[model samples]
Target: MSFVGKKYKLDKSENFDEYMKELGVGLVTRKMGNSLSPTVEVTLEGDTYTLTTTSTFKTSAISFKLGVEFDEETLDGRNVKSIITLDGNKLTQEQKGDKPTTIVREFTDNELITTLTIGNVKCVRVYKAV
Candidate 1:
């Protein structure tokens, strides 16, 4: 089955606070981000993919095509130029701004493993199918 059309709930996270700090997220937003468990839903329509991240604090959605650059407002409130690419069951997103970042989501074993990299700090967030 394709990795699309599945809903996943956040199970656990590692080093997320430190990663957020590296991204220059404010204390309040970082605290709320660390405490919130979000559900992510991915949907595919032709060449476009829609990703929705829902949490108690906020819900954000973005739709984009692979390899195409788009303007995106990140959860930490940074406006970035982003591009996403798909390799096998993994989706890698590169966000360009003052501090460039890469986010990779790998789908396997009914779980979604997300790795966030900013400078030398890295965070891993695991989500299980819900």
Candidate 2:
């Protein structure tokens, strides 16, 4: 098994806060982000892999292989499902039936960068091991 794990302390930056708010996340989630200590784990087994996120507010698991489509509800419970494709070390995901929502992920310098896009709005969250 090839895996990388990191615990990140999150500060609800203005951009992220605004984005989540716009997505209709409740006040609790917004408050949770302020005091969130999230752990992210990535495991790679051949072309199939799993990514997990755990925190006080939410826990989510995603499993996919390269160039596969998976239906996933957004954190806000929106019906934005995506198909993920790996391009080298970066991941590109586009909503299957919705063109307005997209996500991209990249790992570098022991940090994980994830960008979420909804329509014309884009929000980025950065995490590093504690």
lDDT tens digits, residue span 1-130, model 2: 2124444434233367766766677888877765675777777767777777788778987878777777877656666556787776677878754345677877665666778787667888777745
Model 1: residues with Cα > 4 Å off, grouped in runs: none
Give the lowest summed-lDDT range of ten residues in model 1: 1-10
Measured by TM-score, how close is model 1 to the native structure? 0.97
Model 2, residue 81: what's the lDDT? 57
lDDT of 2: 0.68
Worst 10 residues of 2 by lDDT: 1-10
Clash number for every model?
0, 0
Question: Which regions of candidate 2 are displaced past 4 Å?
Answer: 1-14, 96-99
How many Å off is the CA of 115 in candidate 2?
Answer: 1.6
